[model samples]
Target: MKNSIAIRREDLNKKGEKRVAVIPELAKTIIEAGHNLRVQSQKHPETNENKRAFSDSAYADLGATITEDIAGARVVIGLKEVKTEYIAPNTTYLCFSHTHKAQIKNREMLRTFKDRKTTLIDYELMVNADKARVITAFTYFAGYAGMIDTLWTAGQRYALAGQLHPFAAIPQSIETEDLNIIKKLIQDIGTHISENGTPDDLPPFINVILGQGKTSTGAQEIYDILPVENITLAQIPEIYANGDRKKVYKCVLGITEMFRLKAAASLPAHTYAALTIPQKESHYFQHPSDFESNLQAILPYASILMNCILWAPQFPRLLSRTFTKAQWEQHQTLIAIGDITCDPEGSIEFSQETWIDDPVFIYNPATNTSTLSMEGQGIAVMAVTNLPCEFSADASTEFSANLSPYLPGIIAANYEASLENSQLPEAIQKAVILWNGEFTPRYAYMQDYL
Candidate 1:
């Protein structure tokens, strides 16, 4: 109903922080790893609770060319996926958090990788599920409270993976082993639904809700009735405890409709409500009509919240996004966009950094080549961008002013490239071809079918 923040100058710059702060953190990790971390951002040595966890630069030494723009930092990383501009031909990139998109994008920047010329190593493949589970959960919850879309989007992605099945609800009467299998399947189903769902497509997959049966009534009662005993036997409880029953039935109807018409809605309305927040926080609380789009960015990582909050208690951020009153009220909405999430106490922000300079595997068609760049020597790091929510743009311009000092140049560079038709430099282009050939092609292939 309001002007999209994307069109707002101040809001756009504020949203641009995603790119502005990555470099210094990457540099910090590199520095800690005993490597040099340089960035263009005006740098000052600062640390936080998470950063404090790292050993006192015991294992590695890192230095960076600090810069105000994250784009510059990303440029130094020599990662092609983030930008398509320059190639530090000789600079070896070491990064973690490798994704298919990043893989292809990097290859685009370093064209030499596919020519049996360069190297790209994906260290993320080595990460165990446990580690991913920890970080994933925290981000997922933040995605929910903040109305981030990527979290819910994960279900749609899984559907694209060909992991969807008919609605098979977990039965209360089933054996523990059977229930476990159902749980796994449910998780898989959820993943597919999120990853593949679109406004035009089917809801992605069917949900099988196991109605409360007499045999396993206890568990069912716990899930279905909640704080109430089986006071009476009725078609449904007084209220849908967590809206589970209603969602399940709706899923059944949606799935049936999909089969009949060969089409499905992007998502069921019931589930969508749980997945996103309704209250839109004004960005920076400055403009009254700076609303552009709802924050649908957290969908891909939705399950992360369940994992972090229920499964792994080690991580703290699964609770919420840390935002100051100013930030909360500033933007047209309350939540952030992508993997970046706020902390539990709403005091800090954190995000997973996997592929800044990951070992990139690429294939070159120009010279009929395969290449590896940034192999093995990758770094894994997390960033605590702006102070949780304490520093607000309206309260004081200090944050805006100081942000440039800590912002990563890579962020700026990517923003610039995004505006420039998403083109990368020559070398990076080759690298991207190879990267796409290996990783992105898998998804791209499926997309072709879709």
Candidate 2:
């Protein structure tokens, strides 16, 4: 079992990524099961600071080696993307490669696998028999961090507006120790809002969520900590003008509610309009080009917008530049947004991935520009790419729990054999993007991206 499995250190260049693929407690089990483990030393040779949430000594104490060279191990696992040069020949690597759609950024990395004879198993594609995600802790935790950071952005934005508020006291996500502490702080804020209402100059705090998926739900879970009143989209303007200022109002909008048919290119004008809501939804799903951004009706009255949709270029833009400016003129209350999805210039036209070091930006839609300062008439966007890293220990604990059950078996599996005849589980086998330097049948389409 010598060098059976190794957990690589996260890339040092990636700031604020302290989470590890495996924790020390889990490493102890793998060792007790008679599999050798090597955890990359978090002790950077140049710096005294341990970069990882878990210390190297924690793994070493549990019969795991704290080694600098984990690439030589038969199985190397990580949380994020690994460099192409780090992949040892004939070795198997498990991580989120993010090249399933043949992304332009990772084309070279995918090409490197073909010559190195290394197996690339993407965690994102690891789905159970029922097609449910096997690794979901990260997505779920991301929502928690995104909304928390969004609140931080609101505090900062409000302070810039010369409005002194209690929320302005809340720190950034990474500044806090864990989710429990953050939740307690938010609960305190909720109590404060109950005792003293939000600023009268501003409208009611209407939080409009864009999707209903796991990420969206995670955001909702965090938002629920506040004294909130769930309301429908139809009750917005009236609610904003007359609703209790102390209570935060929430409205969740699905894709169909945010986007609509453009010009009826798919069917007759009247027939398309006459279609039932579900039928229209199906049609819009099949042909996204027929849809146009319809968020103007929802965006104007919102104090904060949490975008959690999994979107691409083919989909209609939800918060376009023109729409952002128009909405600002109407209400000026949509000041802060938590783009939890973090798609760069994707659905939310102005949002780009911001790092934890600089997690938010003021997007001036009027000038099509952004500034790091949260000042000016523009809206504030908190779009941290690796949000879960804010609560690294908690995130790592959940990730380790989900991935630990599969580790002992995967470490003991026979990778020398063909992938079809390998000892890997069916779900894991299906997730293999590359096997021994060749594109697996399921991932052969990736060649187009390279």
Candidate 3:
């Protein structure tokens, strides 16, 4: 379970609110520190009935305020920002969100903090190192188990494609520490399920936390605000059992529907921009918020598949060599690749000739960019683990499905030729494929030509 310092939300006037649930232990620590916790509340001009209900209150006595305006109260104690209207200029801002690019982009606010002498600290930096170790153990276990429940079942038993558990990516693009923290949380979940009978015994936030390891609990918890349809057991791993046509179709349909939604929502804004085929002069149709919202929706489904292999029974034994900290670090370095422009009309070439080997790419202390180049490579390897079925990370079949769409023509083509058809010449084929596969074609090419 995450600590209260990681949860607790409060409004000044609302005293009886249930509050955003957090790790109880973390909450106690803040109380013991005697820091006055505060949150922002929007005064609804339309309704005076609840106006000023929680206008002012200390962090310690939050019960009444919480109950009155549950939605109005902001969870400030753990957040990076408590709106300027709510807190004193001197109030400190402590939260993981502070590290995210969106928040950091607010240079004006940061300037205000500096001018006001308000201490803006990332508490995660202080507590996460130790917390991550414990968290990792649990998340690794939960992720490992959840993958099994979601992806594989042979009768009552489950099987794994490869002998090893796959590596799970920490999606927090900025906070490497939080990413580490999330990885730990996943390990913890895996441990709990392996030891316990039900994943229910654990806090729901724990699962949300694992799924949204990179996001703030406040933002991540908002998904619970959305309606989630109950997924029937028959729609899950049952296809591996009875193999009923109706059941299988329903299952596949349900999955395909979900994937469509996920893809739409998860597709990057840049991807959308690429799809838009903008004219020389253009007006943007979507807001950044829209992109952010949709991205959040798609990520959970992706995670469902990404974590599949982690839970397989055979995964722990077969892929042990790859999931280690050293390997994870190596893998982590590879996940971050460069961004490329795509042609909306599919006429332009977006291809890479080669992946230049650069050791300095991992951690260029001199330049201060540690994870940028590594991202692409990491994404390439992560493609295998990101799938929803039994597949080896080392297998070309899995790699092609998970990553090719995201890859440029050169890199993706290189991956296909090198891994899928080993009989093909590596040096000549890789080079030739990049040259020919430069631009995305207007029409999809059939792999089999009769």
User: Clash pairs of candidate 2?
Assistant: none
TM-score of each: 0.26, 0.95, 0.25
Q: lDDT at 190 for candidate 1? A: 44
RMSD of each: 23.3, 1.9, 25.6
Best by TM-score: 2
C-alpha lDDT score of every prediction, in listed order: 0.24, 0.84, 0.25
Error of 1 at 277 (Å): 28
* Candidate 1 per-residue lDDT over residues 342-384, each given as its tens digit: 1212212223232212212222222323234221111111112
Q: How many pairs of residues collide in model 3?
A: 62
Candidate numbers, best lDDT first, in rank order: 2, 3, 1
Better of 1 and 3 by lDDT: 3
Q: How big is the positional error of residue 98 in model 1, measured in Å on the Cα after superposition?
A: 8.5
* Candidate 2 or 1, higher TM-score: 2
- Residue-wise lDDT of candidate 2 within 1-450, one digit each (tens)? 334888888776667888987888888888988887888788666565566899877888889988887756888888788787676788888888878875677778787876788888999998899998888898989899988888889988889879876679788889985799989999999999988988888778889998888898888898899999999888988998898978788999887788877774667668887888889889878888888888878776888899998887777898888877777777566879999988877888888878999888888777889987667768899988899989999999999898876776677788888887777887798899998888899989887877
Worst 10 residues of 3 by lDDT: 339-348
Q: Whole-model lDDT for model 2 versus the true structure?
A: 0.84
Model 2 vs truth, CA RMSD: 1.9
Stretches of candidate 2 exceeding 4 Å from the true structure? 1-3, 268-280, 329-331
Point out the higher-scoring one by lDDT: 1 or 2: 2
Per-residue lDDT of 231-304 in model 3, one digit per residue for the tens?
33233333223332111111111111221122344445355545433420122123211211111222212212
